[model samples]
Target: MLGAGSWGTALAIQFARAGRATVLWGRNRAQVEALARERRNCRYLPNAGFPAGLTVTAALTDALDGVEDVLVVVPSHAFRQTLAAVAATGVALKGLAWATKGFELETGLLPHQVVEDVLSGDVPTGVLAGPTFAAEVAAGLPSAMTIASARADYARRLAESITTDTFRAYTSTDLIGVEVGAATKNVLAIGAGISDGLGFGANTRIALLTRGLAEMTRLGLALGARRDTFMGLAGMGDLVLTCTDDQSRNRRFGLALARGQRAEHALRDIGQVVEGYYGARSVHQVASRLNVGMPIVEQINRVLYEHVSPHDAVAALMRRPVMAELV
Candidate 1:
């Protein structure tokens, strides 16, 4: 694992419990030392003990030592840099995958694109994503996720490596669609949180997500993604789980903002990377470049960055000219 946040720690725990030798690397040395000494990430995923097979390290080389299949679990912004660091180590990676979800900050490149641009080597790669909460997964609750790669065999192998009695994995070849779904959902999840925070009822929240899915499909098709991928775990499952649930950092970020907290303060309070907060910018840039219509995303971007109030955004959305649902 390349990132030591809750999601990374949770996945590291799962890998260790599955009897794989897993090393979790964090950027902070003191924090890594504490986690190493305590055998659990008290700051992020507390109350979840680390398995015996897991090791916490501050050295990137130590984490990459004797690594067979490496899973990078960093945030989207750090995805390329983490891979570059791995490349700098000159280790020959066999099977590589990332659990990061979002577009590059300015370039709007997906995780796969970052891999291609950074690695430029014949390393089989995949993306692991789905509707999962780190706390729940750490507690050994039943969870299912999708592992997608251009190489079907590599995806299957990664799926098998992490799947257990409590956790299940499915494989897919639609990397474009899977990544599109994964990135787009975070943007919509922020809108969902804004709606819920403003005291909008379930009817409004459901409508927001329903239309959000449609907007996501339009953007995905523009990028040549398969339509069915949006209906699968990465799409509908993740969208619903993120937009409706409070466990989502992006959604919680939205909630805090709706309750009158500044973006900086909300992020500081959350103490984790709010991908949706950053996704608002990247997704809007990509959508505009692709000429895709995404009203919800646009409004959320305004609310988050332009200092527009949630109520005003909602009114702006309601005031738009009526159109057919399919459009």
Candidate 2:
């Protein structure tokens, strides 16, 4: 594991509990030392502790050494950098994957794009995503996620490796749809949070979620993704989970904003990476470039960056000219 964040730590614990030796690495030396000494990540995943076969390390090489599968769970902004480091180690990796969800800021590249830009094509690659929270997964509660790879064998291999009694894994070949859903869902989650915070009622919230799925589908189609993938775990399932739960940092950030907190202060209070907050601009950019009309995403970009009020953003959505729902 190459992140050591909440999700990374949780997955590391799961892997170790499955009796596989797991090494977790983070760039922060102090935090790494603390994790190694205390056998717990006090900052991100305080409730979770290291299993017998799990170890934490600061050195990237140590984590990469003799590993069959490398999972990068870093923030989307740091995805390229972390993968580059992995490549620089010159390890002959059997497979690589990420749970990271968002578009690379300037480049608007997905996790797979970042991987290809940094490493050789020979490396088997995939993405793991769905409606999952780190705390529940760490607690060994039942959770399911979709693993996608262009390589069918790669997807099956990872799914087989990670499945446990409490965790289930599904497989998909629609990597593009999975990634599109993962990245776009966070932004919709923020919109959901804002509406809920404003006491807009459950009716309004459901409407936003339904329409958000449509926008996600449109963009996915434009990018050559299977529409059915949006209806699967990585799409509707992930969107519903993130939008309805406060456990999502992106949704929490939106709640803070609806409470009238400045975006920066709201983010500071969350004290974690809110993928939607960072990805809104990039998502908007990609939507515009692709000529896909993501009205909700556009409105979210304005609310997040242009100082538009949440109320006004919601109003704009309500005011848009009616069109066929299937469109």
Model 2, span 137-203: residue lDDT tens: 9989999999999999999988888899989899999989999999999999999989998999999
Q: Using TM-score, give the best candidate's number.
A: 2
* TM-score per candidate: 0.98, 0.98
Q: Candidate 1 residues 1-327, lDDT tens each?
A: 889999999999998888888999998999999998888899987889999999999999888888888899988988888899999998888878889998898788988988889896788999999999999999999999999999999999888888899999999999988898889899898888878898998999999989999988998899888999999999999999999899998899889888888899999998888898899899899999999999999999999889888889999999999899987
Q: Can you tell me which runs of candidate 1 are displaced by over 4 Å? A: none
TM-score of 2: 0.98
Error of 2 at 270 (Å): 0.6
